[model samples]
Target: MADDLRVDRMTEKQAREELARLAELLGEANAAYHRDDAPVMSDAEYDRLRQRNAAIEAAFPALKRADSPSEQVGAAPAEGFGKISHSERMLSLGNAFEADEVREFDARVRRYLNLGPDAALDYTAEPKIDGLSLSLRYEEGRFVQAATRGDGQVGENVTANARTIGDIPDRIEGAPDILEVRGEVYMSHADFEALNARQAERGDKTFANPRNAAAGSLRQLDAEITRARPLRFFAYAWGALSEPLAETQMGAIERLSELGFVTNDLTRLCDGAEEMLAHYETIEQMRATLGYDIDGVVYKVNALALQARLGYRSTTPRWAIAHKFPAELAWTRLEAIDIQVGRTGALSPVARLSPVTVGGVVVSNATLHNEDYIAGRAASGEAIRGGKDIRVGDWVQVYRAGDVIPKIADVDLERRPEDAEPYRFPETCPECGSEAVREEGDAVRRCTGGLICPAQAVEKLRHFVSRAAFDIEGLGAKQVEQFFADGWIAEPADIFTLESRFGSGMKQLKNREGWGEKSAENLFAAIEARREVALSRLLYSLGIRHLGEVAAQDLARHYQSWEALVEAVDLARPAAQAHRAGEEAAEAERAAAAAEGRGARVSEARARARSERDVPEDAQAAWDDLVAVDGIGPVLALSLSEALANPEERAAIDRLVGKLARIVPPEARAEDSPVAGKTVVFTGTLEKMTRDEAKARAEALGAKVSGSVSSKTDLVVAGPGAGSKAKKARDLGIEMIDEDAWLALIGDA
Candidate 1:
């Protein structure tokens, strides 16, 4: 938790700064987990950061940014899948972290209903399955569609994949003609283990947890891949219904079970708050023995009438609350502190701890986050761990909650060594001996050594060859590390020259300690196989911060050719530079006009200067065109421009490109496609495809995907939750279509 950033004591300036940091942190976390399926932080850490953001926003509402994570839902749908807008929004639940909080939830619900202190309330309590949320839609009692809970309002259309899950009833008689059953798609413990074993046998990727396994399986583009996985589902709620299934929540669950849906057997009817807590405890106790994972218990007001009366708050329903279990903690010795450099050169401090068990996982390391965390101070200078500094040889409490990375909770002063001193973070990169600088407003201290830092270089090289990137066989993490250490490979381009340099030499790689003749040949063949790669893969392998797989694909589709993309980047450098210079000059002119006591004329002068100093038409067009592409905003554009402009980086990229046989552009969109050559912008919540996926699909059909609506936009795909973009499109007289219409236009309907 950002417990150290005391919201109540924060100044407006501090609150604003903290809010921005929290927004970026949480937003990245959401994207990593939801879109990339590679989470950098634990759910607990994410929740804590979210809670901190909420606290800061509450304390300084006037300073809240428009894109505050508090206003957002899940990560935007990734590209490649068709989107599905939900008939009824899949809302998340409010969390109660303790029994007292759970009691307070009950009290709040009772107060909302105007119930007296002695009044009793009935609730339905069940385990909150730790799995991917799914909504199954049935038309005329026959399953017709299934979707993920993307951003609550819109999800990915995974109907074909959902059909493979045995627990889902393809046809349900005696149910509403139009029904949407909402629950979780999960992998049981046994199934997860078996699946992992199979993956290992096949030398494929293994899942970190059952939840991720289930989600990855269900989201497979190829339904056959999803069908090969063992997946199950449970019915806990209903979305749209032609008729009411029952009058109460418990009754509805029973009806669902009767309709061939698998409902949790541990679900119980609680007479009051005490019974609900009891059931929560019961579930918590049985969590270990259960076949699947569950992080908490969900308690809902049993009466459907009461639920309707209670209604929802901004994000979650007031009638229902999730009582989350406390994080598991264990005492361990603080062995040492180590700073690790990430791809972006951020120096993260890790606590090297004596091995300890927390929540069935053995953890020997914990995250200290940054200098402030190590110093036990919040950004606002508030003390965490009661001002106790974690020291080497100290017995510290480490905790893990909901599959999050282990973190130090507190230090036991009683067990601290007398000779222990306060740990000092390094001022230089340990690997390169270069200055490590912490920029203003940033929690992380980055290495100024840049690519020269071996730590950063190795990390980036590892990322370049990661499974999602090059996926070069025989060149895994260990191999990458070994080659980098031995000076055999220092960058991506070096891999292509490996065989030519050492294949037939007397000191060939075949004569290395771990390499045999056959293994060396296989490695060279793997490198050769990847010499002719796709433009998207080549761009993604560069490891530019914030340029993910989805963004790379978007760029590939937009530019169509590797040469065109590089030329555009080269053009964008001067264009962006000119734009910045013009903006600065305009600001200066405005200031000079104000100083000259020109009141109303100051605005006029500013406008004139802005227009006169405007970038050249070609330059402006290049910059505007770059930003106009869907998912390619100013931040990413800046990174790409800077990377391509830097001499060393540009040379590296050029070398790599020169070595490649060819960079295959994305497949051209069909000439006969309805949306071909049209400019389309997707706004609000998309039901059929995620915004990214929608953009991809449009681009696939030879349509130019724009992020915002303009007069030039030929069509606007507005979904259920569309807001200002839709209004702008309407005002501009742009043709509008729903997600269904867009899907039909793409011939996917």
Candidate 2:
């Protein structure tokens, strides 16, 4: 322990400099890993540096800082993500890179919890998928939004794309109104290959691996694109919730799964180190077949109550450890080639590699990507660039990419027989007899079959009722696919249209071979419940290109009527002609004078107009007027008016809204309001307040009340000992004002 840490004895100046350097290094590594699943440093190298930094902070406890590199997680949330004050701060976990470290971590957890000598501290272990972490927000029984873990304080909104995943339920059954579930959005090896295959066909660039594919897809500028990708999510832990959940980690996971969130079935609860290690072994063994990429297994204290009691050390929870898997290599033969059609109508080819083992998991197949990829492979499945063609009966080298997928590395040309020939790909769809056409500048081929392909149809149906989309329960991806395969379902409306042979559509639904009465009833109820959703959701569910949650929201607020929205969607006139046809400020002013018999400022005329383009002369006046609102901007205004100009969009919106519920925000959106810029830290007891009250007050006052005090904190309101928070504020030279001071500053009320 002594040698592992050696920094306390240093001068404060040296400590500060060391801390700064550590911050930079960790920040870069975190960004590289989170923003791009590409780690800048080896796990060991990162662990060594982290340990050194922790030691330094421990040695010089007085020099310890709140925003120190050792305490921070990733880079401060990137701008643009909605900032959320976690009910419980989102902390980083302690990493154990070796068996010894794992043992030490085990020791520490027991020591902190005061466990008996023979006490069994079983841990639940799961493969930690190497992907971006996200916080999913559910309000009033609906999946409302999702955000990235920006800086523990803020997160970027990726809710639009998150809506696409079928595993994530938009509305969970038997859950509190407000829930903040945490999960990892990842791509399976199969899905990743299929995605890249499609990309290749389109001549678009491909990601290096599944992790990159998952990260890049989720972070897309357009949520519609994200919706198109076959990303998956598995909820592990949680952040803030309107209410408390089960007492144990496994219990929480079980509860999540029951509530409709997808959970990793591989998770296990071990009773001790031996059992934990065994569980880890089991997980490592299933790595390749697991589909998604997992760099390591995470062992966390099972009991939620126990976890809270163990508390945290600095920024990391003391009750968890990440045990990584060792990397390995093997070789397999290339066999049949198959193409799978996706819900988005994209076609992909999969290589059936002969069986082998990598990192304990058996590898049976790898993604060949596209025609270009196949042409680049040797007859022995090795790269033929200046090299051979990938053919049947050829042995190909396979290696672990993050210890999850068995990726093709090269081919064993020396072992190849003269009988192997180039594997021929199909020129038409395997599922539907549609001509597979390769669009110009594409690497992948498309089954031009559209809605006729069974695979695509089922996939699309599953997407329609996905947790992130309409969140229609009872009709899950599997059930939808099943019904589609059974010929009981077809279009999106067929799900609702399926009549029950029995009573209330339940008995009949239940009378069906696969569905029980209760299950059928429950599903019918859920589907019926969603018959009327919000205009934005209905628009998004239509699966239109270049249209997403944000755009839908904007359109919804812009028109406020379905008739208006559909009218805009169908606009056929050229934008330039419409732009010139709209009313101008000058004409509006003259009209106002003529109409009222007395003319005022151009502002007066503009104020009377609902939109700038309402008048035929000088529309800029009204445009400027709309831009004056807090949330409305020039870009949004232009898009709203231009889109509204189309009659088709407006008409569709009208019809859709007729059957949907109005979405009213909790409150009006706040822009450059009072709470926008300031950081406030509340501490200790308040004579007339609760923690929630204080937080609300600060937020209402246009201030960000952070969980911890740091140099960034502008005001620290202390009531009593305030302990670490107050002291940290003082040490950092931040202003320390008492409760009364805060009240006086905000207002007497």
Candidate 3:
């Protein structure tokens, strides 16, 4: 009755019943492990079930289904990617859990290939990455489309985002006529942790593990967001081939590697099952220290001839086997949701859960990401979710790994008490009492208090200190948030005044988390050191709406002096008034039309003229001029003119001008600067600094920045995001440089 026990020879009907039972159990177990990363039974139990399935299949050859579990090697596809047609359908591999199974597999393969007992057969071994599966399709040598494995028959189209990944070659050198490569999309451990950290910082949901993280990232509807996530892919198989390659498996893999695909470096050729077992054992022992996610090692026949002869079962082939590793997740309860404010004004809701241990780490809170997600949970009729208002007493399932924030997997309907009602969200900002409002097109709600809101103030200050911004050596987001929470820092100006708070007690600031004595001093030093920043950076640090570094530069260049810019903004009032007068005149015309029927065109035109005659002559003149600036249309002119009409803003601008230096014309405009009239592209890692900073500098110096590297690119600053750009640049024989080299050329160092 043991599951692993070999089957007794029987009638085909009896064998079919065993096959049905075995397939059901095996499929469910595999789904549990593959989709959820949760296994209901031990590996031994699974092996036993699988052996029963194989025994049944062996006895009843004609009774198998095309998609039977025994024939499923590793995984099927998921929805949300483009469906790719593989020239050679990518087949799954059959598995062998024990030494006996491996021997039987070898024997069957040898027999099919007509090999005698003395004949030799070889195999290859490679560690299987735990991640989302995808197929890359190329036609006529250009990198074009990539699709996720959605039920094997179809997938989601992610070509745009897939194009952004630098590791995936846009074009292989001396490319083939048609190439379709299969691989696993995974996140490196470092990237996974970093991704979680970023999500936590933004008050958004974090992925439970690297596999889910990679899958979720690829499935995103917004390609830009996916492009931002740290995802990597490694090719393990070939589906469609344009031409034939070396006669052996090792040779095909070598050829793939040479063709610019990231083939697994661990692939090894073995003479028999003994060597394959030895290699798998070695990989199993070394699994802990690998920087990336790995589930198991795959073993495949080294020679294509042997594999073809061995043949296939409905879903899987006789060539390969997946030896799975262990699981890495823990479950806990959801208690409450707390809102977090990110530097960019994104509001994130976090799930406060009971503590859980995953991958040796204790976790209690998971990010809900945004209000939309929380609301979606409520709509799902989850008892703990309070139907839309998560209350204090509800129990919810929290999933975690090494991720800083866990994910709410389920709500405990049985644990919902009678007193618990749906939680209510505050309409006002919790910190500053500003109206909490959700904008028409935004996913997150916000406190419109701007500089007055404690959360936004800290977030903005932290953003100013970010590496791409001012790169303040000591100030981090946590430190900024703590300072804002403690009332020690209310604005960017307060960062310069932290010394005043120190007299009260430096201990409070130091122990506030993400803050320390050395860090605080370094932060102050950084603030002081930035006193001489270019006008553009100082403008960006202000965190003003519609005002980025480029805009600031444009403003600075146009006005020449900060004081003049303020005066121009003040003088711009006349133009706004003029513009408003025109609008008023238009409105009056419409209103006058109601005075008479539509038949009197001349009368209506006269009435409109009369309405404008009443508008103040000077106001009409000012509004007209405001509408003339390039890119400054009627609406933009009115908005700028109205906002600047405030006496307080005028005063603040006056005060700000006194504390800053004027950027000389040479530095202000890019007209004749270093890169002016030149086309420069940024790719990969810049040795001098971040790509953003480098791009900004280059742009300021008059260079045009393009996303792609082309024949016309004057220079290519190759860095880490340098995927296709590097290849294209190299192919076109364009000049490339590292960050340091760029800085040296620009004389920035």
Candidate 4:
């Protein structure tokens, strides 16, 4: 695993960038796992990413993105099936990787409920199945509908496909008039192996694991295909109910069993966290013998009344948590190491290994993270793997939990070949022969070739036309690669000029291989349709670092037009440069002071520089305005300003903008709402709701939620324990209100 940034030492800028990267990576992972039924990364890696994201958010709460991974349950439903709107949202469970975390979870629950330390709390522990989540709805004793857990609120209707599963009863007796049963749709190990053998015999594609097979089988478009496959369902939860099922979690599972549902037999009721951990250990020991895949053990508060009081976070239940198991390990021989350049010009190292199976998946390639990882040191100079550097032709231990991508866990130096030598990382990009430079705080070395590098150019073009960008109908990744290879398109602007350049004549697109008259015409039509796009999409399509979908939307809402945004960037460039210079000077002064044992002068130097810096008032105002745009921070603003200041980048953007018909601004704000168009700051602990809930509510009411109290702030909501921010609000004379007053204001709005 890669060495993660320490939450305590991470700056707000780094936090914002890390959050953006996690959002994109986790979004893709969710789509692959929930919607496509083929996970791209392992379960441990996914859990690690989520944990890192949560830690970062906790450290810098105001930097959370609107589309944060912490608030997402699952990916949106795939296209082929009909969509079903779930009556009650199917939320995800929080995870615990260690015994202490489990104990902390119990303590948190007790704290939230204001119970004494010796309060009696019972929890039901059960194995968390590694399979697809399905919800079966019954109306008046008859199973009326079945759907997959897709993006929580909405799912794909799989009624016909679900009915074929033998474990799911068609009707039930002694059940509520309206009961929505939720459970896992899975395939046993024996069934999965047998199914794979049949698939191989028929020369069809084999599954990677039992979970994938179960998901693939249950989501089949043809009901007959689903019926031919072996699938099972375990009932453990419910969504909507007309009446109470039971008084406790254990009683509810028994009710589900009596209603003709197949419930897992390993379910047990535990007294507290310690008992829960014991049950988890028992389940872990029985995992291989259980005949089904279970990734972790889930513990839910037993009392229904306590659960009702606990309620939920935005995407997870507060009354339950899954204590996940560790990764599975195997040894493999490292063949070679390769560096691949990404869209952002990052040169990432990958390890090619001899085939080995770990956690039921065959592994041949693993991420080396960065050059520092290969050198056996973290970015902060901490020794890892006992300072054992990785070399080619060495034996390495690989681990995988549930992710498709496995990682190297350790190296066996004794098994290394005598001729093996320390690997040398390239200082130049292999593709473009350009110098690769690693920035001071950055972990990866990036190519300096920019658009001149073929790899970066193709990747940028691909991103420009990605699903969330222009999304031209016939211009997929393969098309982009082919066009770039033929020198037909080299940049985003070149995409908009395709028809005019190759619609006819000897260089025509129709003349190309695998191209027909209709297809070529359709491609041109698709490109034409994207001539007009939303402002946020256009900004995101530029592939700016730290500028994600949410950030782009925030920028769009603030600037409203391309011209306005460009002008602001131009005006703010000088002020951004001055700020950078001041920071650099302060650092230099501190270093000099430390070397001379004159620590007292360090503060004076920094204060003098801040008080004497020469920056135009207009430019400073422009910089302040840009940074005040809710999610936009100094780091992101500087990146954007520098991009526009670059000659080549500016020209490319200009050319692309020239071809656009119109750039639509964001929707108008709700003028009637009291908080609409106002910049609001939240401070201290919110008693009525969580901080995230308050931020969401404010944004929904058309108000901008700033992280800190500023002169532009129109309102500040201060709760108990508010300190610096509350005083600042009072000093600035911003309208200060309590949590109840805030609730009243929004309620009346």
Candidate 5:
């Protein structure tokens, strides 16, 4: 059934069947895991099935049923416990399986905030304990009630059971009048083993895992029973607050610690995605030695204001994500190698492995990344295989985490077959017979056939209507494929004309097999709704190389209008070409002069190209302005400019642009404040406002607030506890101001 649920390539009928099967399996699993405290399925298995269900639904949107398991969290509150309704919802964080996804999460927040690529976004990374989520409500700094995160919106009333936990304070002082602290309650491994041993001695049932033991102990009907168990709590977040706790996430955690609530000591402030991932790896390495269970590392936007601006999605916050560690690893035989073509024509290799269970999830396929990965070499030319390359018929270690695709970890040369030969990657796309070439400094082998390649065309079309694109309600990947196969739509521009062409004809979409009258109408209406899209979405929909969501937003913010962006790209293209040609000609002249022993002439030619004043003023300025946009560095700028420069690409874009009603520009921040665009850093303990408040106020006043002091730092606000950053600012001769000075500068003194 799991094998049959590869819904990415499944037909509509197959998707319907798989969704129905998944719903049934997941419904029972939820009951067993949440209600009965006896899980019939592993966490890995549950996550995989849920992922498959979501994929199937995404492909066949019309077939999505309301009772879908993907819409659910934990099971409804257990029968015995009283239910409590939360004022503010307790949502879960979306999972990131790989380092790139974590980086994407950070970039996404920056894009939403319209920040420069180089702008620092501080993050609080902490251990994601594998325990039941508990929300404790306090009134006037006194603990009033506590509840479990039963189904996000409502939870079981475990206040009586919660009081027994020693880590939870009966009352907190110097806190907001109305505060609701949310955190995890778990039983340590030692405590769990001891409790189980005691239960065995008393001829009672024992728990399977620490998480289960903790949940069962907390949800017990007898309060005394829960009081006897060693259940601990770690406060990390909050719900409804009458007054703000702290300005930043880390500050709030610190305040919680001061109020006598236990917080994870491993929590630290991280600067960027790389630092966050480094901390994640550190936590993963120490996971086995930790006294309690933690499945992953959770990263949240440190700035409370930023977190507020990047608000909640349907069931998760957009500003935070959890990076789950690999759940399990298993050795399996590499059955074969397969090549898959992406929307961008990149040919990716996949490893087909014999079915094996890793983390209780059956994996028959794993991503080989690219050709270099298969040959035991890193993309950066580093050795990875330790003298044992992966090959067909070789035993390979496969690892799985969260719902991400399995990956090949290592190869067992001891079990390799004698007759196996080195695997050769295809020089042409398997879907279409086209020449595949790996670009310089790139690991991927891409098809050069462009639109002629069916794989690339279908994938691009599918992407055009994906959630992050046009997001037509009833038309999904499967629908897009169906329409493409029927020749109803060939390009994005064709979508806008769909109704006029086929809305009332004999070839109308309603007459299609899978589509009904309502669904067809819904799809057409959705398409029409997106006729006027945001400039950022339009740029992202183009799917240009290296121009991701973040880059598109940066470009959109820089060029406020669609016409401005198109004109700029058109103008930048020629300038870039001229600049590149000039550099090449200069290099050639330098080489020729050096060959002839004319050292002075060679130096002069090099200087002409290198000097700012020697180049065409307009061309140089255009290039400079293009790269000046935050996040749009030289490489990305070149790709964007060239993509717009291509005649065919330009023609298609023009057609698409003509069809749209208008491109909405990003909202501009107020720039009347004196501190607008000034880079300011605050250090030490701020007295007038919380660190979060100060950052938010500075940002509101149009200042670019930085977390650290650097040479580029314009001003430093040193508080009473000023430290190294203040010293650095002083050393660099940067203006040092106090809180009062900052207020005076902002004209609030």
Candidate 6:
């Protein structure tokens, strides 16, 4: 489906499928941009896709995927660098594309703080730097470590490389004993040009843009390479401070500058949305002359107190937003169209374009989304781009806004070649000659080839070793592809037997074109290191549909062990299938009744379907328990059950499990906390904190917070306007308390 489709017009099935596609697309985009420093989609297109995902989620809240892009930050840290867990999460800022969005942001701040329109609120507006995010840690006023913002919670250590930058201060005279300065590491246009020229002169690959150059240069394993690069820093934020920097945002920036750290000189203090927008315009006007790349303007609540009160969401801060500039457009010729199969067997189309410079980067390809998109219609049959279909040999307008690759914005039909014909989308998988089918309510066509398709097999193997999964140090995508082609590592279990199979023989890895003895040994050691993996990592590495990092973690936490999880899934499978069958039958009955003009029969069929779905009590209970975990709805639960029930998949899983040393459970809960190991529920309005804050605090205290009141609930904390849940708690005779009493009980009051 086109990302621009209206959420209200979409059916629930369409919304679910779109969300899954967006999650996969955005996940890949995040990895490309953050981990590899090679983005595959334009920033504008990325933002639009995220917005569409969010809108669909909001429209159908229950249908939201556990791996929704809205809840994710940067990709996991790339291998080769030692990892660093941030003292505080390095969150991404929310974006505002229009003037109204900026205004809405301000209004949201006011509402959250319970302030009116007339309240005196000020903001700090600065250029949103287009570069890599870095965090510098200092203890006793001396620099100690620097890290790249990998995923919000963890990062890649680059201390030695960071020390090579001239702008970074090795020591500060008067600062907090422990401080973490957060900012952007950027390359100026002049420096980037010189570096690229030097690279070209030396017969090395030139970087695409200043941002990419800066990121690649900073992440280099060799500190000398980073020293040679002319990278600059602009300290704008701080994390994990022993003492407060200042009372306000502007004051903090001033303090940072006083400490010998380079801060953005154009940072300005503004009051209200009007002034913020004015500064945004001023920054945009000066963008070309700034020397450094900045894609937008950032606005932060000036008062630190307000910022603290506003708090943060899962992936972004509520107290700040990035007001993004519009995309830069350029005309390019569409040369051809190509179809690529993803791990999920979706046959995605790509538009090959004649090389053109867009936003200082050369563009050769753009995502076609799906066949519906190429045909100029959304899944709902809505006309997009004025009903102009994209074709090979047509002149297309491409645009770039942020870090990713450029995208085709519009087609110039007048410039189309006379002999160009409408492209025929293939009905068969190009890689395996298998039937490619588009299921009902699905926009993208997928191959039915399964593991037989090399493309799908390779992509799945790549996902299994991705940074967030197994993450073997020397076993990356290239190696996985090579091994797959050689038929030495066809499945997850095959990976564990590499050494025994080819360690010392003539056909060993060390004998390969690029491999040495040391490298081969290192790869073997890395694989050995992952033998005793965490249950969450193991689950994610399986490449199950709809089971992402977060969902896997959730399941791992609930099930605790691999054996326990498999048992639960096995017990729940029968009931899950029964329920699905009943639902499908009910849907068919409703459609037939509606077609025959029997409205009463439709309601009767739905009631009968619900009765027919009733399975044995034990099986139904097991299915209920499986779905009871937060974020594990019927869709994800059913997918899990089906995956485990498949003979081929289950056999592979069992083989992989047999090769492992152990699957570690999650860390133990906070034993000393008052709510440790207890399930708690919160209801109605919270006066002292937001619901999110309450939930976070509860979880931090080792409590299992539930969304609904049930027999398992140990306590309920009800506030003003408490209704159904509060009543349910009372009816069940579960212990209940008001917000104040609850706080006092937790020793926070």
Per-model TM-score on C-alpha atoms: 0.49, 0.44, 0.44, 0.51, 0.48, 0.50
Best by TM-score: 4
Superposed model 3: Cα runs more than 4 Å off: 1-427, 430-433, 437-446, 467-471, 500-521, 574-679, 686-697, 706-715, 719-721, 728-749
- Candidate 2: misplaced stretches above 4 Å? 1-20, 35-45, 55-67, 327-749
For model 4 the local lDDT of residue 372 reads 89
lDDT of each: 0.83, 0.68, 0.65, 0.87, 0.82, 0.86
* Weakest 10 consecutive residues of candidate 2 by summed lDDT: 572-581
Tens-place lDDT per residue, model 6, 255-305, is 999999999999999989999999987776555456677888999999999
- lDDT top scorer: 4
Task: Kindly list the per-residue Cα lDDT of model 1 for residues 338-448, writing each as its tens digit.
Answer: 889987788899988755435534466899989988888887689999998888888887787445688888987976899999989898988788899985446788887
lDDT of 3 at 515: 66
lDDT of 6 at 707: 86
Q: Which pairs of residues collide in model 4?
A: 41-403, 41-404, 42-402, 42-403, 43-402, 43-403
Candidate 1 residue 681 C-alpha distance from true site, Å: 43
lDDT, candidate 2, at 481: 76
For model 5, what is the alpha-carbon lDDT of residue 658?
93
Q: Pick out the ten consecutive residues of candidate 4 with the lowest summed lDDT.
A: 354-363
From the highest lDDT down, the ranking of the candidates is 4, 6, 1, 5, 2, 3
CA shift at 424, candidate 3, in angstroms? 9.0
TM-score, ranked from best to worst: 4, 6, 1, 5, 2, 3
Question: Which regions of candidate 5 are displaced past 4 Å?
Answer: 1-327, 401-405, 505-507, 578-615, 671-749
Model 4 deviation from native, Cα RMSD in Å: 16.0
